[model samples]
Target: MTAIILAGGKSRRMGFNKAFLPYGDKTFIEHQIARLNKIFDEIILSANDARLYAHLNLPIVSDILPERGPLSGICAGLIRSTSFHSFVIACDMPFIHEKIILYLREQIGGYDVVVPQTSRGLEPLHAFYSRNCIQPMYRCLNEGRLRIIDFFSEVKVKIVDEQEFKELDVPTQPLVNLNTPEEYQKYCDYKAPNQRES
Candidate 1:
């Protein structure tokens, strides 16, 4: 399977590129790539500007529909993906564990999408997408239906609820994403002590 990182967001609330934000010893994107490399053979970066991530030496794909939001990025990734199924995640989510990812991978059989639903609701970015969803997603983008879940009804969506997550000892931390400076700072502060101890 392949891994797709969505990094094309405007990051208006962050006031800077969230992908470049420091998580521990590495930048957010770098950390994600390092972790994903251990699980996936191929990793595709979905960004608006390929030049920004050219140094990473991965396949950086720009949105085919341009600025249509994450749904557009997912479309681009799925189009470029060599695998039948791909694990998609936003760049700002730093706590996504390998166990959670492996669990999602196991649930992908005969499903177009295997998404997790936490107390916060459906985590579209942190989900698995199949090649079968390509057309429905493209149709959504072409029709200006930018919401990620707009095409869910047209596909075989297997929603992994919180109970399922608990069975695997998975917590909501994996779905916690930093969208604002305050959230970023809070995470940094939370990790500072752990960093020093290490």
Candidate 2:
């Protein structure tokens, strides 16, 4: 399976490029790639700012429909992916759990989207989306229905519940996203001092 990292967000809330922010031992983007590399050989980054990620040396895709939010990035990645399904994760979610991702991949037997639903609500960014969803996703984007979940009714969705998420995320901090400076600082302080670059 291919892993698609959505790194194109404007980061209005975070006030800077959250993708390049330092995490545990690397940038947030690098951390995600390190974790996903263990499972997927092909990883793609979806972003409009191709120059920013050029050094990563991976396939970088710009949204086919510009300024359409995460849905646009999803559509672009799904279209570019060679696999039947691609695991999608946002750049700011530093606490994404590999076990949860592996579990979600195992559950993608016959669904167009396999997303986890916590008390935090539906997590489409950290979900598996099949290329089969390209058409519906485009329809939603073109119709100005930018909400990722808005197109779910037209496709098969497997919702992983909060209990399942908790069981898989051993650190119990999966899906923790840094959308603000305070959240970013807290995450930075939470990492161990010994967590140096490998």
Candidate 3:
């Protein structure tokens, strides 16, 4: 299966591009690639700013329907993926667990999407999508329904429950994503203590 890193968000809430934010020793994009590369051989990036990500040395595809949000990005990635199923995630999630990724991949068969459902809601960006979703996604985009999960009823979706996610991502860290400056700072500060101890 391929791994699709959705990096084309406007970052309006963040006030700056979170994709460039520092994660460990590398930038956020680099950090993601290094980890995702371990599980999937084909890793593609879905972003509008192709030049900004050219240095990453992976196939970068712009959204098929630009500015339409993550739904469009997911559609584009699914179309470009060589595999039947692709693991799609946003760029700002720095704490994505590898074990969770493998678990999702293992659950892909017999469903068009394998998504984690927490008490909060469905984590669409952090889920697995089958190429079978392409037509339904495009239909949703054409109908101007941009919500990521708007087309769920049209497809076979397997919802991995909160307990399953918590087992792999202990304490259920809420899929920490850097959407605002405060959240980014909090992530950095949280990592500081562990980095120093290491």
Q: Record all residue pairs in model 2 with backbone atoms less than 3 Å apart, i.e. clashing.
A: none
True-structure lDDT of candidate 1: 0.88
Model 3: colliding residue pairs: none
TM-score of each: 0.94, 0.93, 0.92
- Tens-digit lDDT string for candidate 2 (1-198): 899999999999999999999986689999888878888979999999999999999999999799899999999998999899999999998775667788889999899999988778988888999988899999999999999998999999999886875565355456677899998887765542212334
Tens digits of per-residue lDDT, candidate 3, 10-31, equal: 9999898888988768777787
Model 3 residue 70 CA deviation (Å) reads: 0.8
Question: Regarding lDDT, does 1 or 3 come out ahead?
Answer: 1
List lDDT for all candidates, in order.
0.88, 0.86, 0.84
Candidate 1 — which pairs collide?
none
Total clashes, candidate 1? 0
Q: Give candidate 3 regions above 4 Å deviation.
A: 169-171, 190-198
RMSD (CA, angstroms), candidate 3: 2.5
Clashes of 2: 0
Q: State residue 148's C-alpha deviation in candidate 2, in Å.
A: 0.9
Higher-lDDT candidate among 2 and 3?
2
Residue 138 lDDT (model 2) = 96
